[model samples]
Target: MTGRVGIIGIGQSNFQPRRNDASYPDLVREAVVIAMRDAGLDFDDIQAVVYSLSPDAMVGIGNAERLGVDAVGGRNKRFLRINTGGATGISSVITAWTHVASGACDVVLTAGADKVGECGDSQTVLNKIWDPIYERSLPLGTINMLAMSAVRYAHKYGMTQEDMARVVAKNRRHASKNPHAHLRKETTIEEVMASRMVSWPVKLFDCCPQSSGGCAMVLASERYIKQRGLEAVWITGLAHSSETYYLGDRMGRGFTADHADAHALGASFRKSFRMSGIKDARKEVHVAELYAPFSNTEFHSIEAAGLADIGTSPAMLREGAFALGTNAGAVVNPSGGVLCTNAIAVTAMVRIAEAALQVWGRAGERQVKGARVGIASGNGGDHQFFGTMVVEA
Candidate 1:
C-alpha cells in the first residue's frame, strides 16, 4: 500500500423490494455498465475484480461471484470474493483499494448485488449470525438487538419515542430527493409513530426495506488517474475494527441489556480521523453516510462517527442540524441511507460511493453544499465488524 488510491467511477441500480425484471447477474451488470461508462472504461480496463455479498443462501447461489464475473469483465482476470456480513460492500472496496495501492493492479473494480427479498425468511438467515451454543435460543434478530439498544438509549438519555420518529421523518424527506432510494415518500412524525411497532420502540417505518439492488465502483492509482485525466475522489484514510465475537463477551454474561455503545465503531472512526488529520468531524467532515438500518441505530452511529455528542443527536435533529441542505450542521445520509434502502451486500458500498459522489461534485439532487470532505461507515456481523473511511475531493 504505497501509492495513492482514489475512486474514479461509481454506479448503482434502483433499489427495490424485488427486481423481477432482472436475474441476479443481470442486476450486477446493470451497475457494472453504468460504472464502466462513468469511468470511460470497459471490461478490458479492469485489471482485477473484488466481489462481495452476505451469504450464498441470500441469493440462492453458491459462489455467486462466479455467475457475475464475466458481466464485470473479470472472467479472465484476478477475481476474489470478500464477505463480512453487512460490511461486505465496503470491505470489497477496501480490497480493491489495497490491490491498486499495493501495485497489484492499476485499475480495479469492486461490485456486488443482493436480493434479500427473494430469499425466504431473511430473519432466519440472519439469526445464524449469532452463536448457536450460547445466543441462538433467544429468538434474536437484528431488529430485536436494535430494539434493546433503543430502549437503553431512551432510559439513559431520556430520549422519547417522538425523537426516533423525527429521525425517520427527516430521512424520509431526504429520500424524497434521492431517485435511487427504495423508500422515497415524505413522512410525518405521526406517520412514523403510527407505523406498526415491529419490536417495541422500533416501528415499521423505523426500519429499512429489503432491497434488491447492485452497486459497483472503480478504484485507480494516481498514475492511472493522471494518465486518463479522470476526475476522482481520494480515499484519504480507511480503517475498520471488530468487537468481541460473542455479544456475551461485549456485555457481561447474563446481561439483558442488548443496547450497544458502538465502542468499536467509535474507535474505527478515531483511527480514520487520525490517519487523515481530521481533528473535528463536525467541522472537517461536511457530509456522512452512516450504516444505520434502523432509525434508533442512527443515534448510535452518529455518536460513533463523532458527528454529535453521545446524547445530543436527538436535540440536533429537532433543530434541523443534520438536515440535507442545511448550513446548521453536518448533513448526514443524503442518499436516504440504509434506513431507506438495505441491499445488504451493496448497502455499505453505496455509502462509500455516495460520499465519493459528494466530493466529486456529482451527487446531483441530494448533494450537500460546500461538502469538501465526506465520511462513510459500515457495520456487520451483529455490529461486531465496523469500517470507516474519509474521502476528499
Candidate 2:
C-alpha cells in the first residue's frame, strides 16, 4: 500500500499473576528495551513516544505516563498519552502511526502498562464510567453488562449457554501455546458449565482474569525502514468510533444501536478495509486477533468484522473453521486471545502485537504459514467504543 507505515519491532513482558520485580515504570522500560532491540534500533532512533493506560485509579497514581516517559526514551521529545478505557492500547498505536505517517517523526514508540492486581476492586472503578443517574444504579458489573448481550444473542439466534462455553474452551486451548498467556490450561464444556457464575450466563471461566503486564511496539516510516534495510509490515488502514456514554441511549434498539452509536462495527470495519485497499477481508486477511473478554462477544465480533454472516459464528466454531490449517479458513486468536491472557490495559495492544508477529514470521511455534494480511480490533466502554486496524506484510 502507498503512504504506509510499518511496525519494525514489538515487545512485551512475560504476563504473570504479579510482576513484583518491577515497578510500573520498570515494566514499561523493560518492554521498550525489548522492542528497540527487536527493531535493531537504539533509543537515539526514536523521535517520539505515545503511552497508554486505562485509568489512574487502577495504578494509584495520576499522570502515570509522566513517570514512564524517561524509561520510554521520551525525555525532551514529543510525548503523548491516551486513555480510552479498554481501547486505550489500540488507540495508542493509532496515534503513534499518525505521528509517523504525517512525516513529523521517523520512528515512534507506543506502550501500555497496568498493575491491575494492586487495585482492590477494578470492577467497582470501571462501574464509575457508567451513567450514575440511570445505569450505575443497577450495580451492573462488566460481566453483567456482557451477560445481557449474551442473553440477547442466545434468544435471538436460538443458541444455548453451551455454545458460549465452547468459545471459552477453544480460546483456552489456543492459549496453551502462548508462553506469555495469563492462563495456559485447556478447558472443557463440562468444566465451564460447572464454574462459578458471576452473572446469569457468565461463569468464572467465561471471563478474562485481571492480569498485570505491559506491551510496546516500534513504528517506522517507509524512509526509516528502507534506510535500515529492515523488513516491515505496512499499516494499511486504521479507524475508530465512539458512541454516547450512557447505556440507556441504546436500550430497546437492536444490537446496532447498543451503547456506542449503534453497532458501528460494520461501518468501522468497512472504512479500515477501504482505506487499506483490501476487498473481501474474509478471504484476503490471513489472521484475526480480536479483543473479546467474554465468549459471546467473540461470536458477535466475528460477525461484526465481516468474517462471517450474522447469526453464523457459533456454527463456524462447531465446524472448526477458525482453527489453524482449515481450508479457506482464517486462523483466529492463535495466541489464546483475551480469554486466556487478559492484561486489561495492554489487552488490545496485545492483539495488535500478536497479529504483527504472525506477519513478521516471528511468532515461533504459534506462527501461521503464508501469513500476509492481518486484522486486529478492540472494544471498550460497554461496547460503546471501537478501534480497528489492518496490517499487511
Candidate 3:
C-alpha cells in the first residue's frame, strides 16, 4: 500500500458553450479514448474506475455516471462516483490515485463530462446547495458569493475594480492561446472594464462561461510504470480542506478560513507542498493551474497557493507577474483557468490535467518554458471545499 502513483496520461475535449452534436456519454468516451491512447493502454488494463460528476441537476439527469459506466470500462471493475460541487474532478483524481497507492489497483481510470450549458437555470440549480435553514435566505449564488468576497478583498487590500479588470484581460489573453479554452478571444483592460456589470465589481467579462466538455486521466502505480517503461508525471503532493458551510461565518475572522484571505486554502496547499518536498513554493513552483472561476478570486487563490504573499497578488499581478512570458518564477493558469472554461464536474480535474500537461511538456503554445513543478487547486460550494495538488516532471 506504500506504492507511489503518477499521472501517466491526460485528455480533454474541446470546450464550448454547448456540445449539441454529442450526448454527455459521448463526451466521456471521447476523453477516455484520448487518455487511453495517450497512455498506450487498453481499457482492459484499467483495474478501477472513478467517475467524476458533480451536481446531476446541472445535467438534468440523476446518477449520470451510470450512463458512462460502460464507456469507462466500469462494468465489472471497481467503480465509484464522486461529487464535491466544483471540486469533484480533482477529488475523483485523488480517489484514483489512492486506489493505485493502496496497492489495490495497479492502474485506475478517472473520467468525467459536464454539460452545464444544458441546465435551464444553472444559478438556481446551484443555489440549492445553500442551507435553506440559514444561508438560503440571502439568495447567494456563485457570482454574488464571490462578488461579496471581492468586496471584502478590496476593502482589506487596496484592490480596485481596475485590478479585477486587469485580471480578466490577462486571463483572456492566456485563453486566446489555448484552443481547448471556451473563451479564447483576447480582451483588453478597457474592454473588460466596459463590459456589463454582472455582480458589481464582478463584470460579465470577469465571469467564466457555462462550458460543456469531458476530461479523462490515466494513473498507474510506480511499479506498473516501470514495468511498462511508460512516461509519467508524478503526483508529488495533494490534499483538500474546507471552510464553514455558512458564508456569514467566513466574513470577519475566527472561522474556517477568512474571506479576505485564503488562509484555510493556504493550509491545504502548504500541506501538499510539504508532502511534495517543496520547501519554498514561490521559488520552486514554476507553473500553477488554479481553480479561480472569477477574476477577483484569482488573487487570493494565488496567494493561498503560496505563489505570492497574501494581499500582494493584486500588485504583483498588476506588474505583469503570473503572465505567460513574464520573468515571474511561476505562471498561474496557462490553460486560461476556469475563467475561460468551466465544466463544473471537470473543472478541478482539468486544473490538475493542465498542470500535468505543463509538467509533461505537452501544453503546446501555452506551455511555460522549462516548467518542472506545477500546482493545481479546486474550490467548491461557497468556497467551502478546497483541494490542492502538486505535480513534478
Candidate 4:
C-alpha cells in the first residue's frame, strides 16, 4: 500500500422488504447524500467511484449501473462497476481503497442500491448461478445449497437444530436494537423452532429476508484526512479468496477444504490478520460483523474468523460468548447481521460499514463497547467467493 486508507463516512438507508417510495437511483442518491454530508464533502471532491451492483436482473434493469453513474455524480470521473454476487459491496469498498492506497485518488466513493425483495423471478435468477448441466438439474439455489452446508456442519460437529435456533434468537434480539434492521422483533429459541422449515434444518427464521436498500461509504488517504482534519476509521487489512465452482470438490476426505468446516475461510482470515500485523485475532478483534445469511452458517463463520474453533463454536455460543455486550468473545453481528437485514448488493458493505461505526463509536444502539479493532467478511456465489476486511479506530 502506498498510502494509508481511512473510511471518512458511512451511510445506510432504512432497509425493508420493498422500498416502494424510492426508485433505484433514488435510493443510490439517498445514501450518497448521507455519506457525503457525513464526510462534510461534495461530489466534486470524489476523484473516483466504485459502483456496487450485483445481477442487473435483480433490479429488472440491464446495465443498471449506467443509471447509478448519474446518481453518484460520475459524469467525468474514473468509475468502476463491481459485481461479485453478495460480495459486491465490500468488493467495491476494497476496490475504492485501492484507488486511494495506490495514489490514484485522494478520495473515492463506493455506493449501491438493491431491490432484491421486488425481484419476482428471484429463484430463477439465483438458480442460474449453478452449472446448467449438473447442479441446475438438482435445481439448487441459495437456500438449499447453503442448507446442504448447514447439514454437513451440523452432522460433523453434532450441532442440534435447537443450537442453530439460538443463533436466530440472539440475532433477532440484537436486531430489535437497530432501527435500520428489516426484522427487529426479538424472538425466542422456541419461536425459531416453531417457524416453518424451509430446508430440513434451515427454518424460515433461520434464513434472511430479501431486503431492499442502499448504502454508501467515503474513503480518503491519510494525507487527505490530515489535510482536512477529518475523523476517520482506518482500514488495517483486506483480502479475498475464491473456492472451486463444484461444491463437491470442496467437500469430503481428500479435498483441501471441507464443506463442513470451511477451512478456506479460516485461511482467508489468517491472510487478513497477517496483513493487519495481528498474530491472534481471537484476542485482537474486539468486534466482528460476519456475513452469515443463515443461522447454522454463523457458527462456522465464527470459527473461520478465529473467534472460536470449529466444534467449540456451538458450545461457546451457548455460553453467551458472542452476544452483544458480552466480554467473552468479539461481539459477533452486533448489527443483527445479514440474518436480520440482507440487501444483497449492499449487505457486505453494511458489514464493513457497521464495523467502522463500532470502531468510530458511532454505532448507536447496537454498538459493541470499546471495539478498538474489528473485522468484517462477505460471502458470494455458492460459498465460493469470500472477502475479509480489518478496520480500526
TM-score of each: 0.96, 0.96, 0.98, 0.98
Backbone clashes under 3 angstroms, per model: 0, 3, 0, 0
Candidate 2 per-residue C-alpha lDDT over 256-299 given as tens digits, one digit per residue, 9 for 90 to 100? 46531226656777889999887887888888898889888888
In the predicted model 2, the residue pairs found to clash are 256-262, 256-263, 257-262
Poorest 10 consecutive residues of model 1 by lDDT?
250-259
Local accuracy by lDDT, each model: 0.87, 0.83, 0.91, 0.90
Model 3 poorest 10 in a row by lDDT: 251-260
TM-score quality measure for candidate 2: 0.96
Summing lDDT over every window of 10 consecutive residues in candidate 2, give the lowest-scoring window: 253-262
Please provide, for model 4 over 1-393, each residue's C-alpha lDDT reduced to its tens digit, 9 standing for 90 to 100. Answer: 566899998989989999889999999998999999999998899999999998898988998999999999999999999998988898999999999988989999999999998898887999989888888887788888888888888778899999999999999988898888999999999999999999888999999999999999999999999989999999999998878788888776688777776666777788989999988888899999999999998999999998887778999988998899788869999999999999899999999999999999998999898899999999888887788999999
Taking the tens digit of each residue's C-alpha lDDT, what string does model 1 give over 38-105?
A: 98887888899999777777898987888888777876799999898888888899889989989989
Candidate 1 stretches with Cα past 4 Å from truth are 253-258
Of the two candidates 1 and 2, the one with more favorable lDDT, higher being better, is 1
Candidate 3, residue 141: Cα displacement in angstroms equals 0.2
